[model samples]
Target: MEQTHSRVAVVTGGSGGIGRAVAERLGADGMNVVVAYSGNTERAAEVVKAVEAAGGRAVAGRADVAEPDEVDALFDTAEREFGGVDVVVNTAGIMILKPLVEFDLDDLDRMHRTNIRGTFVVSRAAARRLRSGGALINFSTSVTRLALPTYSAYAASKGAVDALTLVLARELRGRDITVNAVAPGPTATPLFLDGKPQEVVERMAGQAPLERLGTPDDIATAVAFLAGPARWVNGQVVYVNGGIA
Candidate 1:
C-alpha cells in the first residue's frame, strides 16, 4: 500500500469488514495496530491475529467510539502497548435505511451517536495524542454525493464527518499530521450488503464504471495511502469508488 516503517495505528471498528481489511493492510505495511471495537471481542481478536500474521504487532480493545472515556482509554492502550500512535482510523459506524419521512428517530439517533459523535470523540483524542507525521483517517460515504434514497440520515451524519475532518486538519497547523476522510461507494461489506436484494446489488454494481462493487481491500488501499506517503493530501475526502462519480 505504501512504504513501511515502525508505526503504530489505532483502528476503530476493527472487527468489521472494511476496518478489518484496513487493519490488516496497515499491519502488512509494517505498523503495530490496536484493533479497537465496540463489541464482539471475538471478531476483534481475529483481526489482531490477522495483523500479527502479517508480521506486525497488534492488540484488541473495546471502545464505544461515541464515549469520550472509552475513546481515551483506546488511545491510552495504544500508547501503553505500542509506545506511540501514528495512525488513527475511525471506521466504527451503523447504518439503517429508511425513507427520511418514515425513518425512526431512534434509529437516526443511534446512527448519529456512532457516525458523528463517535467521530468527534476519536478525532478529539487523535488531535491531542497522534505523534508528529501521523494521520487521522475518518470514514465518510459516497451517498453524500450520490444522494441515494433512504440514505439521507446516514449521509447527513457522514457530512458532519467531512466537515469535522477538514477543520481538524487545519487546526493541527504545525502538528505535521494529515487529517482526511475516505468516502467509499457501494462497497462490498456486511454493512452495505445485509439488506439488499441480489438484483438491487447488481444494479448498483453495474452503475460503477468498473462494473463491480468496491472490495474492502480497495478502500483499504486508499486508507493506506493516506496513512503513509500522501502527506500533502489533507483536509479532503478521498473517494474510493470505482468511477461512481
Candidate 2:
C-alpha cells in the first residue's frame, strides 16, 4: 500500500475497541490522525502515543459527537494540526439491547442521542469540511439485516445511518468525496462482550460460517480500505461480518 502522508483522518470514539484500531491503522497508513474521545482522556492519549510511536502524526481531542460545537472544534483541531481533513470515521455509538415492548424509553432516547444524532452531527461537519477525495465512514450493525431478537432500537438507529450514508453520497456529486457505512456483526470487543454469557457469545460466534467473532482489527481493515484505496465504493453499506448476514 502506498503511504498517504498527505492525508488527514478524524476518527471518533477513538479511545478504545474498533475506533482505536481504526485510528492506529490510518496512522500506520501514513495519515495524520485526530483521535476524538468523549471522556476517556487517558485512553485517547495512549492512542495518540501509539500513532506517534508508529512514526505518524496524531493528537487526541475530547469531543461529544452529538454536540455540533464540540464536533466543529474536533475538525478544527485536525485542520489546525494536520492542515485539512481528508477522512472521517464515526465509530461513536451506544447500543442497548432489550425486546421492543420491554425496552425503556429513557434508554431508547439515550441510545438515539448518541447513535443517531451523534452520527448526523459528525457527518454534517464532514460534508461541509472534508477535502475533495475524502471519505466519510459511519458504523452500522448487521443486526439490521439479521433481524435478530432484542435489537429493535439498535437496528432502527443503524437503519437510519444506512439512509444517511446513501443520501449523503448522492448529495456530494462531483465533489470527489465518498460516504459509506460499515455494518459489523458480533465483534469481540469490550462493548459487545461486557454482559453476555460465554454460551451466548459462543452461540453467536457459531452463527457465522467462519465460526468465530470479529476482532477490532477486522473492522479497522475495512475502514482503512474505504478511507484510502476503495475510492469507487461509495454510498454502500459494506458488511464485514464473516458472512453471518
Candidate 3:
C-alpha cells in the first residue's frame, strides 16, 4: 500500500464496534476523523481520545443519520471545524432479527428508517459536499447474498443500499467521486452478538472459510481501502465475510 497523507473523514456510528474500528483505521491512515455517534456520547468521546492518542485529530458528535436536519448539521460541523469532508464512511446500521411472519411492523419500519433512510441521507449530503477525489462508502451486509432465515427485512433494507450505491456511482460519474458498499458477514460486534445463543454464534462463525467471526479491524481494513487510495474501485459491494457468502 502507498503511504497515507493527512485528510478528513467522517465516520458514522463511529463509537461502536465496526464504526470505532473504521474511525481508528482512518486516523492511522493519517486522516482527521469525525466520529459520529447516535446515542453513546461517552463511547464516542473514548474513540476520539483513542484517535488522538494514535497521533490523529478527531472529535465526536451526535447525529441521527435518518434525520435530514441532523445530517446537514453534521456536515456543517465537519466542514467548519476540520476544513471539509474528503471522505465519508457510513458505518451506521441496525439489525432487528425475526421471521417475517413474527416481525412487528414497527420494528420493520424502524430498521428501514435507520438502515435505508440513514444511508441515503448521509450519501446525499456527501454527493453535494465531498471534496474532489473523495469517496462515499455505505454499509450493507452478507445477508443480502446469504439469504439467511429471519433476515428478510434486514436484507431488504441493505439490498436498497446495494442498489443505491450503484445509482449514486453513476450519478457522480463526472465528479471524480467513488461510491461503494461494504458487506460484512457474521462480525463479532455487539449488534451481531446481541440476543444470539452461544451455539448459534459459533455455528455462524464456523460457516466462514477462516472458521471465525470477523473483527472490527477486519471490516475497517476494507473501509479504509475504499475511502483512501481505492478510488478506482467503484459502485460495488465488497464482501468482507471470510468467503462465507
The stretch of ten residues in a row with the least summed lDDT in candidate 1 is: 1-10
Please give the TM-score that candidate 1 achieves against the real structure.
0.97
Clashing pairs in 3: none
**Candidate 1 or 3, higher lDDT?**
1
Candidate 2 residue-wise lDDT, 56-136, digit = tens: 799999999999999999999998998899999999999889999999999999999999999999999999999988999
Candidate 1 Cα lDDT to native = 0.94
CA error at residue 180 for candidate 2, angstroms? 0.5
CA lDDT, every model vs. true structure: 0.94, 0.94, 0.92
- How well does model 3 score by local distance difference test? 0.92
Q: Between which residue pairs do clashes occur in model 1?
A: none
lDDT of 1 by residue, 20-78 (tens): 99999999999999999988989999999999998889999999999899999988899
lDDT for 172 (candidate 1): 98
Angstrom error at residue 88, model 1? 0.2
